[model samples]
Target: MVTAAADPTPQTADAQPWGRVDDDGTVSVREGDDWRVVGQFPDGPPEEALAYYERKYSDLASEVTLLEVRHRRGGASAADLRSAAKAVSAKINGASAVGDLASLDARVAALTETLSAETETEAAAAREAVDEAVKVRTELVEKAEALAARDPRTVQWKQASAELSTLFNEWQSQQQNGPRLPKSTAQQLWKRFRDARATVDKHRREFYAELDEAHKEVRDRKTRLVEKAEALAPKGEEGIAAYRELLDQWKTAGRAGKKADDALWARFKAAGDALYGARSERETADAEASREKIAAKRELLEEAKAVPDERDLAKARALLTGIQRRWDEVGRIFPREAERGLDDDLRKIEQSLRTREDADWKRNDPEQKARANDMTRQLTEAIEKLEDELAAAEKSGDKASIAKASEALEARRGWLRALGG
Candidate 1:
């Protein structure tokens, strides 16, 4: 059988690594079966030509080595490595330079196979991350929905509004930095959040509007009260009790906003202060007028003080009665405390004089004297009868009857002496 001719470029003692220069000034690279002409380098020496082609082959080998290193170090993405491996494999096939080209192809193929599994794992991880992001976003949406569901009247609007703002900011931060969610899922969460915000805003606005209405009503009521209170200033002290009633109404009237309430209260309080000022001035004037009355009453009390120590009860009674009549004519004293003190002192003297008169009446009563005289006669007769019984007992020699009669006669005599008979 005829075989292919052996390479005409003989193998020398110093052989090149990948390419050899032929006599025709052409460079040939070795394949598995034969040598193929790659290019000519006419101006260069044979060794230089061989070296040039060998450098090209070294470059290809270096690229494949770098890819292998990057794959082992895991510095580049598996997809990017797969692409690079394909590019390098194409360059190695029928390449202009050579250094174990088949082995480089085998290495690239191995790298491609390894990257397949890695790409699948990376894709799965990315999907999982997106799912977690969606879950977090859904939780935020649920919180907003709950806040919107609260009754408007019961909600503390300031705190609730702040919480909603915080949640919205968190959503924005997550959207900007976190894993991107699927389009449909992101839209759904955003829609729910938007609707909840709308509901909260609507409720807040309505609540404030109603509050303003109520405040207006309170302002109207307080304004009327302020006008009435100011009108009472002309009544002076006489209007105090009536003004007190308006003040009570003012207390029950709710808030009318800070500025209006403060202004209205200033006017109302000024009216009340005016009334009190009038009352205070009147009291001071009355107190000055009462000094003379208090002096007159003191003089009367000194005169009445002698009644309690008088020797004649009848004369003391007459003098006290006259003093009391004059005291009434003195009229009432101002500052009730001074009047009470003077009246109490006079009352004590009057009570003493009356007690003495009562004792004198009891002592000289005719009816009491008559009753005493009658009792004296009855005791004198009983004494005589008991004395006779004593004598009979002594004669009869009955000592028990004698003792009993003597005791009864003594008791009767003692009663007659007590009656002043």
Candidate 2:
């Protein structure tokens, strides 16, 4: 096969350099130091015979390039790439190709080393992500567990329930989108979360159950209150005080459910409305019936007004006494408001007359008369002394002394006259 050193030139399609054609059309490919028979191409030319096998070598080189591309792009798993690289290496080692087969094997080997490092790094990252995900999921579970551990009575049920629901939604989202944790850890965390949720659910049910019972009791109480309030409605305006008492009771009555309370209150308030309505109607009737009495009282108030203006104490007393007698005769006014106003007006007039009468009585007292006489005597003596001083000042032509004496005498005389001296 080493005839004159077999063609060691680079293979080409036309030269068929990696192969030769025998006279009998037997083709042989150059393999190391020997020529190995490949196939017979009795009907084709030498170039065609070698070109057919050259196409095979091209196909093999293409496979190696594709594998390298896949490895570079991370399009296949590391293990899958390794397996593929081995297969391609085997194909290239003794491949029917006439191109650089050794170089292709070297490229596959480099790809295997690269894939090993990449696989290790990716595995570490994936493990870290899983651990972090477990930590986050564990935190969520702990939060839910803490919520479940809260005192049921103190927990604001509405807010707690909303938070629990939000936690559940977050758990589902993490499960679907976050890194997958180990099966055992995942199942354990899920069980804990589910139990916490179940505990919250149970507490919620129990809390609402107690509230419903309390609400039912309140409803029954309000229902009875409503019946009692309605019973008072038949008594008309006379029952207004009783209805007011029932109203106080209604205020003290605890709450039922919203719908029930609203409905029951409507009925109870209607009963109260009936009582108030009766009172309003009665007031209207009384106001109409009291029209003449109001007029009579107004006339009396006008007559009594003179009592405060009376100059004669005895006459004012006589007039007030007559007015009081007639005021009683005028009878009661209705709606009471107008009655109170008119009575107040008349009483003020009477009080004025009484005050004047009291003054008069004080003036007529024997002790008062004695005191006045004594005062008049003292003033008379003081005036006599002042007159003497004025005369002396006039005789002496002392003008300042005369003026001062005159003023003092005049003041003393005025006091004496005021005492009815």
Candidate 3:
């Protein structure tokens, strides 16, 4: 038969209550009106352990389960709860359980390891993205630099440069946050930059090629003009015509190199000057022949002036008429003192004949003397008008008016001299 155990002291309402304990050895003690769990523990339980705690104390299984769910959702996992429970139990026991502590420590360590791995994976992905962005940015920058070096004035270059600059800036910002690029991206960027550079170079080469061709055309035209000018240097009148043609060609020809232009001009000028000098010498010889003719005309003038004043007026008149005819036959005199000398001598002879005619008219009848007086009055009026005209002409320095007034005065003097006779 079984022996009955001694009865324990009965618990009263005033006595300190036994606190609830979870399956994982987490205890919940009553503090005033509320229940406070001593430590957190895993939610899954040994069913008997949980039932014992519910029976010993007021039922709190539902509240404990709710707390466990809240903790789990808030990043505190079953392993965290278990680790906390072991720490609390060790403290309460006042005896170090190295093995229990080690098991709890191992669970925490494994969780930490998993978190670190996940962080490393995310970091690596971020680094890769950054690297790709950096590669793109570097390519954009190089392309922009090359385009800028080309003609900045062109619309294409300017637009391309601006776009590249903006893209590069964005790419650099991305690179700062991301990882380095692989070899493929780097090569692609370099190729784009090189293509831009090559395009610019091609444009420059074409520009220079056109310029060189234009210069060559100018040089050819100038060379041909120089040869033509040299060829016509020997011909006198013909050379002048050729020289004009050369000048026209020179104007039509586009500009040559500086040295070539100067050399060609000098050669052409020298050839033309030689031809002109020869023509000038021939002109001088013709001028000498003209001078001789003027001298002969002047001698004729002096001979006519030396005609004697005789009673035989008819003979003298006939001689003067013959001299006048001879004067007409002579050619143009030299434009010098010889021409003036001829004019003076001829004027003297004409004045003497006019005086003789006036004397003859005065010696005639009373009707003739009346006519002479009337003519003299008219002459005096004409002289007075001429004097006024001469004064105006002198004031104005009008050579043509002065000459015309002088001729009128001389004609009036002839009329006045007839009156004296």
Candidate 4:
């Protein structure tokens, strides 16, 4: 992308008229309407002298042309081009050159003008970029400040710290790669960020410090609770009530950190398990001792089954009463589930007998029988009336009335049958 200076129209020394050698072999270069003496070349022909001086002009021209190409190619900064133009223009003035020196001066001037405009545009763009970078950094600083303002109790320290780290990294990247910021602005933003970060760190440390103290308190309390629980293992099943009270105390105990809590819980639960284990062994012994009692109760249940078979309610009641008294004498069974099941079975038999006795009482009760007979008599009267209506309706050829009467009669007969009247 590097460019050479602008090329001028090519001219050979023979056709070139910008330089000449006098009879004394003195060389002079044309400057506008007048000519200026450049050097003496007495030992050479006019052609040689002109040629030699014209070569110097060619060198100057090349330098100007190189500047033009550099500007056009955009490979050099405007400032750099401006500086190079200034140096070349100085050399162009009053030189012993034979080419178009005026044209070179004009080109250098134009190049400077172009560079000045480009310099302003570049400066404006750089300022915009710097402003944007400042804004970005300021926003990051504000975010850090926001985080610092949050209540330590409410803030999740892990996530907050991570966000701060990310912001810091972004700030670094912008400092190194993005547009430069003003020193005061950059320093101000950094101070704000540093204060915010320091606040957050201080809060985190204080919060955890308080938490550690609280954890130690809870851990010690639980440790004591566990020791008391373990001490109860020698009491066997009798220690269960004390263990339950300790378990209640454990419910209100706060966290003791994960590892310590888990270890302590294992010990505490083991103590409770020991207490329950003793109870279980005693229960098993009780169950074994009550096996005979359980068998006796089952036998009584079988004997009581005969109570329902008796035709006389009084005799059934007497038999069930005797069986129930004997059942109580047989004593309680262990593994209470077996006892509950047997009791349920006996209760069902009792319920059945009670139901049968109730039914028998209703069948034999004089008041109930009297009521039934009264109802039967009323139904009989209703049936007689309906039958009369049916016969009359049939004789009159009134099919609707006949159907109604027949329905009433059928219903009344069903009721009478139910009453055994």
Point to the candidate with the largest TM-score. Answer: 4
> In model 2, which regions exceed 4 Å deviation?
1-124, 244-253, 351-421
TM-score of each: 0.56, 0.65, 0.30, 0.72
Which model is ahead, 2 or 3, in terms of TM-score?
2
Candidate maximizing lDDT:
4
> Model 4, clash count?
3
Clashing pairs in 2: none
Per-candidate Cα lDDT values, in order, are 0.84, 0.82, 0.61, 0.86
**Which residue pairs come into collision in candidate 4?**
5-65, 5-66, 6-65
Clashing pairs in 3: 127-179, 130-178, 130-179, 131-179, 131-180
Candidate 1 lDDT (Cα, 0 to 1): 0.84
Residue 277's lDDT within candidate 4 is 95
Q: Rank the candidate models, highest TM-score first.
A: 4, 2, 1, 3
Candidate 3, which ten residues in sequence have the lowest lDDT sum? 1-10
Model 4: residue 355 alpha-carbon error in angstroms: 3.9
Better of 1 and 3 by TM-score: 1
lDDT of 2 by residue, 1-421 (tens): 1111123234434443466667676766655456766666788776666666667667877887898788767667787787788888888776654444455677788988887887787789889999888988899999999999998999999899899999999999999999888899999999999999999999999999998999999899999988998999779888878878877887888889899999999999999899889889888998999999999989887888888777988788888889889889878789899999998998888777778778788898999989998898899889889989999999999999999999989988988887878
Full-model lDDT, candidate 2: 0.82
